[model samples]
Target: MEKRLLGKTAIITGSARGIGREYALRMAKLGANVVITDIDLSAGKYKETDIKAKSVKEEVELLGVKSLEFEGDGTDESFVKKVVDDTIDTFGSLDILVNNIGGTGGAGPGLATDMEVEKFRRVIDINLTTTFIFSKHAGKVMKVQKSGKIINVASVAGFVPLFVVQPHYSAGKAAVISLTKTMALELAPYGVTVNAIAPGYISTVKWDAHFEAQIEDLVQKVPLGRIGTTEDCSKVIEFLATDLSDYLTGQTIFVDGGLMELNPSSSKIENYQI
Candidate 1:
């Protein structure tokens, strides 16, 4: 196997678990030193989940690449700056940045009209603002080097409304896509490439039991006839991290198994009117 990302140093936010964890591990295997950070710290009264940052860091180190773990809020400007600073100080250079920190605020489903204004702002802060903070800080370092790759983790829900998750989550993700495009254009002159990966219906242990039925129903809607996995998203991130996608920027790649192409599938025949 060729080491596509050899000599590269990558910082991945929310890498304690889920798709972010997969990205960290896969990048390490491809010969990139990885830095994993997450807001979830098991220090206080909160129970430690399986997808903790320490575990992901350990796994990355096991791959024979140096790994650093940090516990901080992604939405914090100073925190994000520190993450970039630490990456440079420890690794000597920053080559790739994966902005994967985002969530629906653990708030259950609700209509756009009924969603609280505060909750909406929180979602935007976590998903969109954090992306901006990381990209801006990382861009500064990469600009000086004249070469770097930045991959933002968007969601298929941003393109097509899922209706199951909050509308705020979808909107924030859409903003992420827009931010990615803008950054790509701005950073292109410096030899930096920025892009986004919109993953669809990934099956993870974090899904609530009630979502199981919804997940099963969604599988039929996917042309590939199966829900996506964390590894599915990881492979795409891996590609974006390598020189193979150097020419690609200001683009959003949908890892939806062809679901994004069809407006309505056979499964949605009953809802299709056109």
Candidate 2:
């Protein structure tokens, strides 16, 4: 770790567990003061990733960087604004914002036609609306300061249909990718870079269980012949968060192990419902 993000402050949404947790840890390891926010700080228990520290905030603090923890709805504009305000109040600067709060959000049919309206809306709010609200408040600060990094986490499902039934998830992520581009254009002049990372078949604790039976079949579909990991996704965030990407903005880097390039599909396993 070369401390690429030394002295910066980063706020990662839904960072109590899963890929979001990885983002928090990686940024902290790079020396950024990390703020962890999620509806449940103990969310990792649901997926069996809870660490000895019991929470991501403590985990980050153990890495020798300042850490802030907030428990709230990432979609709620008020809470998001407070988080942004507090981040600036505490760290004196908000250098990075990773909009990582999102998920499939339902175990229903996930069909575009008959899925419950509530489920569809939940997916969109968590994925797209949260991103918008965070960026709006953070962009205000970054614009005035004229330097910042905003990374939106998307999914390969946004680019192509999935063997899993996640039309709502797909639609929400697609919107995130589009939102990244538009945000980039608006913030570029202010020296703020906005980018999105679309991950494919990542094997998080929850996902590992969800795709347990289909892992082999799914790996075969990926051109790289492997499932992606949280580290794989975090590396892209590292790039977008650091000065290495000073010249890049409004881009969606696919951390899919070449699965997207192959136009992936899985016929061996039955349609997995999310």
Candidate 3:
């Protein structure tokens, strides 16, 4: 059997570690030449994170495909544009782009009342603005090619109010979903499909410290009674990145173990009765 993404080229931001690294690895496994772009860089040599990117690159290379590592802030307009240009210059063309760079401004989750304005702005810049920059530049390239895949990494917080306490991060992710739909609508005519993946409680190295306790609580809340893995999220992305989803666009798929479908009213009533 042949790989689903054979001969494709992909640019996955934040590919240094965590979910982004998983995306790079999974795409490469499918025979896609991946560009691992991250904001983190080392001084003398590639750090552990960069090593992860290099390892994926090596694995892909072993499969007879090319890979590259790029270090830069995905939110910067010039940097993002240059990444798109460099990928085309080096690989000859661009096929897929995964906007996987985002976080809670390093503050974890905080109450809306205590969140600072600057922190809120920074979160928006990192999550929402970065998606815009990549989509805008990559959209142009894909339009010219007349065929491309743009997958924005959104969060389940975008659909429900799960991250309401962390207003900034929640708002930013919500914007990502909205932007995904808008881009999908605009790019549909150009033969390009744009979609968003909204993942919930995915286990990554970044959350390893509190993984166990968080998983227990999260599982109790989820209908599936389990937290998601990086592979779980990657599977949905694989579908969106291929012709398997050619007719699907302007949509957000939540890979949350059915967490979003739960009835808040029923749960609340049960709690009150108890």
Give the winner by TM-score.
2
Estimate the TM-score of every prediction.
Answer: 0.91, 0.94, 0.89
User: Which run of 10 residues does model 3 get worst, by summed lDDT?
Assistant: 265-274
Winner on TM-score between 1 and 2 is 2
TM-score of predicted structure 3: 0.89
Compared with the true structure, all predictions reach lDDT values of: 0.82, 0.88, 0.80
Residue 163 of model 3, lDDT score: 41
Model 3, span 1-274: residue lDDT tens: 2588888999998876778877887888888999978887332134334343245556557666789877888878999989999999998789999999888747566666887888888999999999999999999999999999999999877766564456777789999999998998899999999999999778765655545555565577777777788889999989999889989999899898877777342122111100
Error of 2 at 232 (Å): 0.8
lDDT of 2: 0.88
Q: Mind giving the per-residue lDDT tens digits that candidate 2 earns over 1-274?
A: 9999999999999998989999999999999999999989888864644574867888899999999999999888899999999999999999999999988554445567777888888888988999999999999999999999999999877777675467778789999999999999999999999999999889888888777887897787888888888899999999999999999999999899887676435323336754
- Choose the strongest candidate by lDDT: 2
Q: lDDT tens digits, residues 1-274, model 1?
A: 4788888999999877667777888899999999988897332112224443347777788888998889999989899889899899999999999999887757556666777888888888989999999999999999999999999999887876665446788889999999999999999999999999998777766653446656666677888888888889988998899988988999999888777775375223121110
Candidate 1 Cα errors over 4 Å, as ranges: 41-54, 208-210, 263-274
| Model 1 residue-pair collision total | 0
